[model samples]
Target: MAENQWSTAITSVKPNEIRVRGYRLDELMGRVSFGEAVYLILRGERPGAAVGRLVEAMLVASIDHGVTPPSTLAVRNAASTGASLNACIASGALAVNRHHGGAVEDCMRLLARGAARVAAGADLAAAARALIGEEKTAGRRLPGFGHRIHTDDPRSYRLLVLAREAGTAAAHVGVAEAIVAELAAGGKALPLNVDGAIAAVLADLGFDPELANGFFILARTAGWMAQVIEERRREKPMRRIDQGAAVYDGPASRELTQG
Candidate 1:
């Protein structure tokens, strides 16, 4: 490409503009924080205050779900197997593509669906059970309600409790809490794991259900890198073989047989 062709084409801000990318920094500065800026960059509009803050919190919270995170584990596994940098990163993405990394978003959808019923005073327990039943009928696994880790994700519960105290949309917070309590009492002790917590807090704050998971994927990518870093430090990554295709009788499975 021509030198600075794109630079000249895009200049939203000048030196005195105090801009980001092209926006005037001074004007858009307090109008939105870094979190809002993030939204603006990705979606081209500043989200509402609640949304901005909640999205930021979700982003901050999405990182490093310990080494068990498949992305992290994939990186480590790649390192152990002697994968290339690209391959290692690819592994991380592969891991996230599965449900493990995307559960928060799935949970968000469940909460929103349940939220309407809860708002109508459908009974929190009933709402949860109904939601789970609906999901089971759809042949889908329920997302954010349960956790494999904590008996009760204390962090999520604590955040929900605090969000309720924050002004505006407190009822949504209550609804989220009620759903959590109902599910916890009925199902496994899993009380609002990370996904559920993010879903509740973001939904309460007014983020779209999808944004919750996208933000999580963005943050979890870092954890993947962290694993790669650790693996690199210990020993270079090893590319993992797709065991499904490993051929044992390459010679015996002759051209005619292969064809």
Candidate 2:
């Protein structure tokens, strides 16, 4: 190896071949779902069949929360300024900071702390109550409970079901459920939102907390691109972007048909 040369184990490039985590890129193209490929590239191992589905569900759950989300708004605003696609996407990515698209990582850390308490022989509910009390005493809100919109996030329920079916519901998931139950029992009733569910599922699936928000960024990139395209095609340049004044005129309720 050359002096001071950097190296990465993520991918290898040769004259006419490319490999990711030791799998041939061309061969992996059609054989694996994007979620499975993502798992392989990130974790350096192929996911079990059900794990891929759960991962895909997690991606879908955060694909697009609408124009109100900061990321999407950033994308749209950048697009309206006649920015290039990459630049607009970069703008959106930058908006995914601590308060916006970061709940997954934050919640994963919270769940990990609770899971560690449980591992040390603390009762799950008791641990949860203690954690909640600590957070309350600190005047800090729980990262993944409650939402500005839905009382019960449908995506959260679906993701958790998929996680259990995928066999990835373990300690972190149990801790999350315990926290929710504890909150409810205390008359607070803060439901576990989608971020909390993803955090638990990802933690149980052996993902590091650092990569939690990356899942959201990957999924939401698709929506950002769509928003960017729409902004370029429909709106005048340099116009103000207002989330509150936006209305959905694209489609009404619809059903998907299976072939």
Candidate 3:
């Protein structure tokens, strides 16, 4: 085989035929919902109707968190520089890293580990308590359990309720609930955030935890484009290149001396 040769089973295009994960594009058009299509492309199979609905809810929850997010700010700043729309959106996506939009994946890994412990014969609540204790011992802040702005994340609560109604709540949801209960027993009242709820749902849906952040990025692209267009329309070019109120917190200004 050629060293540079690459093969993929994801998609194939040849002579007016396009297939995604074994499904003909023509057949899927106007048939599968966007969320199902996303699942098909990523997971190699389309999700069931209920799972598709849950996927759509996750996308909606991640779409935007106001214009104050770093991703949105990056997009608007790039738009101010007269960059192309694609560039602006790319900038925004690039800004979503471990600190900004990474909790979904993090929480998914935690949930998976806890579920495995339960499957190995440990009591569900006991496993959850042990996990929390381990995290606390390591001085690691638990992700997806708290929010800076919301005392109780309405999105998280709604997603859980919907999951119950959809009959899709499974071991992952139970483990997540157990973790919450353990936290409350410790007198730390941290409500689950949207990322945490999405993490649990994705686990129940059998998605790879590694893809959680990517899903978030895919959903947020729509919001980034909207912000880019709005910034281009309402703001002046290069308007924020320099903020007049910036302060120098370093050493006093010094003059260069001739050698």
Which candidate gets the maximum TM-score versus the true structure?
2
TM-scores for every predicted model: 0.69, 0.94, 0.85
lDDT of 3 by residue, 1-259 (tens): 9999999999999999999998999999999888889888988988888777878888888898767778888988999999999999889989987657778888888888888998998887988898898889998877778877787889888889878877888878888888888888889978888888988988888889888888888889999988888778877888763433334454566766732
Query: In model 1, what is the error at residue 162, expressed in angstroms?
Result: 4.6
Better of 2 and 3 by lDDT: 2
How far in Å is the alpha carbon of 196 misplaced in model 2? 1.4
What is the descending TM-score order? Answer: 2, 3, 1
In TM-score terms, candidate 3 sits at 0.85
Residue-pair clashes per prediction, in order, are 12, 0, 0
What's model 2's lDDT at 216? Answer: 89
- Determine which window of 10 residues in candidate 2 has minimal summed lDDT: 250-259
Question: Ten consecutive residues with minimal summed lDDT in candidate 1?
Answer: 241-250
Report the lDDT tens digits of candidate 1 across residue range 88-146.
87777677642676776677777788878878888766777787668779997667656
lDDT of 2 by residue, 116-181 (tens): 999999988988988898889998889888987788889999999998898789888998999999
